[model samples]
Target: EGIENTNYFVQTSKKKVILTIFENRVKKSAIPKFMEILIFCSKNRIKCPKPLADSKGKFINEIENKKYGIFSFLDGKSKNNWNKRDCFLVGKTLANLHNKNLRRSFKLVNNLGILSLKVLYNKLKHKINGLIPNASKPISDEIKFLTKEWPRCLPKGLIHADLFPDNVLFNEDSISGILDFYFSCHEILAYDLAITLNAWSFFDGQFKKEFFNEIFKGYETKRKLNKLEKDKINLLLRGASMRFLLTRLYDMVYVSENELLEKKNPIEFYKILKFHQNLENINDYIK
Candidate 1:
């Protein structure tokens, strides 16, 4: 009875349970890898929905030619109206998660840029050819730029990688839980921050200064940014926007029937890109 990705809610006399059934189409390698990451995040005090273990203490089960897993239901609601505090908390949480010393225990997940961008580009390039008018050249140019720039921006770490509002649960005024660890991976901390900032700072293609300040303030509380990191943020934000826009446009044209996945408007990121283009310095909002 859940809305997204073959999920079910089971109510028993003792407890309520959530069953997430993974798609069989996904690579066999992805199952254990995803489970390991989720388990690690939960153990690390990341506020993720707790994975329930079976009698054997295994967190996942195989059934019906698909994978199923149970998680404790987090109690909270998604807020439409966001403030500085919320932004700050989210930013701080992300920083803490990225900064944790996983050491050599966690296997680094690769192909993030490829999976999030390059693969999708290869699939959509022929279909979107000439259909979007002037969209092609800029999109192509951005892909080229990001391909080179992403690696140079930062190194890999444990990142939520997808921290949109819908993926978070808040109780009263603070974060109660984080959900959807499917996109969790080893990636650039700044890249993760960029994704979060793009989602948290701006609204409907417009920059919200207070919200931006709140998030940055919150993040800096846990992890201070160096001058180089600060200098790169605006451009990184533009890259994040383009990454999202590309994914959204591809999904809109190719996978619109995925009713469970919330479709994002590409134009919103485009607006953010244009807004930054007009700014002379990234610190304009920080102060």
Candidate 2:
């Protein structure tokens, strides 16, 4: 259902399912960990897809050397535009995801680690030339600073790194499902919150302070943020902005003609990074 994977809606006599054919970038060895995390989250009452087994009991299998997987179809529509209640519900669910995964340790490491991000930035600079003229200086400076300043010692756990609004589904007033664990990895938990803030707290190029508060409040109800996490959140926010911006930028520049994915505006996250750069305290995110 995304750029990296081909998805099809499947219907059987008894139930509906989604079948996914992973693209080439996905490593074959890592399939088990992804399936493991999905099963683990489902068993812990998290709203996510569970991996279904094949005739041989494999969660995933290869047909013509292409890896494919099957998952139960979660019944809910993805809401692109969310109100405060939506924000709070997503916040609580996200916190639940973090808490549930935090207790379990996975052997897989974050493939998109700090070093790879820096490398992405370098590739971005060369590819993005003249596209955003006069944009390089500031972005370069932020990347350079974060190279040394990105925190690594914070509380580490699994996070759904791609928890944008569309990935969260709501049925009436409650969140019914959380989708897309393909990007999940072990990292600083606060960084996950930062990504959520950038995704949910901003709309139409402006920050919604009340929505941010609702989200943060809902999050704290489940997992309390430490002083360090609060203090370093702005930096983490910048890092999150950079992460999305680079990925979107790359997609926009090099997207294939027949690709079925939407290209997000990289400039949206550029503005977010700019706003985070101006923050003097964590309260800047709260009203």
Candidate 3:
């Protein structure tokens, strides 16, 4: 269940629903918290799925030692490429999600926090060079540099750390729904924005300036970024890239080369990381 939580769509009389089977990749205890996040977002007028309980009024059901959940499917299609307008709306919507105060607290530590990232890095430190050919050096150096550089005193809040394009659904000019909140957790809010910058603006191994500025502009329309968040965002961007790179590297190495599973290239994030590492000021991204 490393990356294999299976989700299937089921048609209902009125609308579609999604049934998710929680694989071992996700700890079972976090299911309740996930349900809470979705419900919280829905209550706040965000376009997201509402968790549906089974006939027993249980959100999480058990069968054969596995957990199951149901969600009302949102009516929109996921986007592979977003225009400038879509980026703006996504940015504003994301900021709105961050600024929202949930009615209750749900505590699940960020699995991709600095400490966890380091642990993953160390896990691959030995076989990295042999496995990927000249990949270990930059990862090692990035981890060391980020440890010394990434800010720890930034403002923290709930964040959907995995805000990639595929996880977002579009309806005409707006984001109909934000999907995939499994990575939601309490973390530095600015770091979450940084992750989006890396995901939304950086592409094809290059950073797009126009898309980057438009997103920050829309984000400011909802909640303005303070000087500290603006200044250290580059460091956050680099760290986010490293986090992804290490995770992808681990996935690539751990899986047998002979297996039929498709392996994603870890080097793509490496190029993005290298680009962000060279930028000095946050103004380079947002201004």
Candidate 3: regions farther than 4 A off? 1-4, 102-104, 255-263
Query: TM-score of each candidate?
Result: 0.86, 0.94, 0.92
lDDT tens digits, residue span 108-172, model 1: 57444633676677777775545455666666676776677654645566777678887778899
Q: Which ten residues in a row have the lowest lDDT in candidate 1?
A: 101-110
Q: Report every candidate's CA lDDT.
A: 0.71, 0.82, 0.81
Model 2: weakest 10-residue lDDT segment is: 127-136
RMSD of each: 2.9, 1.6, 2.6
Looking at candidate 3, the ten consecutive residues that score lowest on lDDT are: 1-10
Model 3: what TM-score? 0.92
Could you give the candidate ranking by TM-score, starting with the highest? 2, 3, 1
Ranking by lDDT: 2, 3, 1
Report RMSD for candidate 3.
Answer: 2.6
lDDT of 2 by residue, 1-287 (tens): 33457779999999999998876556877877889999998889998888999889888888888899999888887777789988887778888888887768875677775657768777778766566656766877888888789887799899888888878877877888888777788888888888998899998889999788888888888989999999898888888898888888878877775676677878898889888888957877674
Whole-model lDDT, candidate 2? 0.82
- Per-residue CA lDDT of model 3 for 204-256, tens digit only, reads 76678888887888888998989988888888888888888887788787977
Candidate 1 wrongly placed segments (more than 4 Å): 1-4, 24-28, 101-105, 114-119, 126-133, 151-155, 256-260
Candidate 2 residue pairs in clash (backbone atoms < 3 Å): none
